[model samples]
Target: MYVLKHGIKRNPEKRWALPDRIFFGYGACAILAGAFLEHPSLEGFYGERIIPGEGFSGNHIYATNGVIAFDYHGYSAREQLLEHHKRGWASRNPGWHCTIATVDFDLLDTVELNRRKMLGPDQYLHDPVPRARRFLRRIDHAEGAARALRTVTRSQPMLRVACTSDPT
Candidate 1:
């Protein structure tokens, strides 16, 4: 069984939303970043893996099912994840088969999946440049990431629910 973790961060006006499609399929272990699953048939084949880097920094433990189109806020991360998958996993897996969904936390919130629990949420909506820089600085840097992860677990919501991976 894959230990799956997925959620999005939402602060007042903005949210760091990850497309549902990113989680779909058997995710590979790219970095020592987190746990990943393997396909039964394709034993050696691992899915696309992109570690949080310079301009991007949102770490999520993936396993899943489903697809969705991109909107403005989620476009960058979505594009990066998709492009990697297209070049790697798609060619290897042929018919990529899997399904992924997020647990509904706040009915009022727009993003279905709340990832604040894992990578923490992005609070700088208005200041995009600062947010991007911070994401790179903190998430990419070892010392900064350790400090940030501590904050994420400490500030997590009271009641956190988890969902299983549905490898459709």
Candidate 2:
């Protein structure tokens, strides 16, 4: 489940509006890649994610480890993620194609650094790392709480009562 801990801060009147919107994806991709890549089992990718029939495409980033992929949507099977995009785009634009062409993860750092240089002064893009970390912390805390609840539930014994028919 993807929890949107923050909302988009949009200001159409600002001169940087367009660029800020574009770089927001890049910043998010980089931040998620960085956060997930902190785990040794994951690998990160950065590139263009395309929805061919809809004629939509954009620079994207994600982390995966063969079975699962993580991005702004949180953890999901790669196929599930693709299917989600396909369904979403088809619903809006009537298309059934979705694919990703990834580049090296090393470029993410450079991309993020340049994104920072370009949009760092803007309030929307400032302190991306801290924001990402905070998001991670929230997820971790939630997961931990869930696990603790499950443990407590499991540890408790179930109650049972024998039913007897009354004889008159």
Residues 25-114 of candidate 2: C-alpha lDDT, one tens digit per residue? 433565545654555233332232331433453324555543345566555555555555555545655434444554333423645436
C-alpha lDDT values of all predictions: 0.28, 0.43
- Cα error, candidate 2, residue 116 (Å): 15
Which candidate should be chosen as best, given TM-score against the real structure?
2
Tens-digit lDDT track for model 1 on 29-110? Answer: 1111112122211122122222332333322332222121111112122223344443453344444432223322331122
**TM match of model 2 to true structure:** 0.50
Q: In candidate 1, how many Å is residue 46 off?
A: 23
Look at candidate 2 and give me any clashing residue pairs. none
In terms of lDDT, the poorest run of 10 residues in model 1 is 27-36
After superposition on all C-alphas, the RMSD of every candidate to the true structure, in Å, is 18.6, 15.8
Misplaced by over 4 Å in model 1 are: 1-76, 103-168
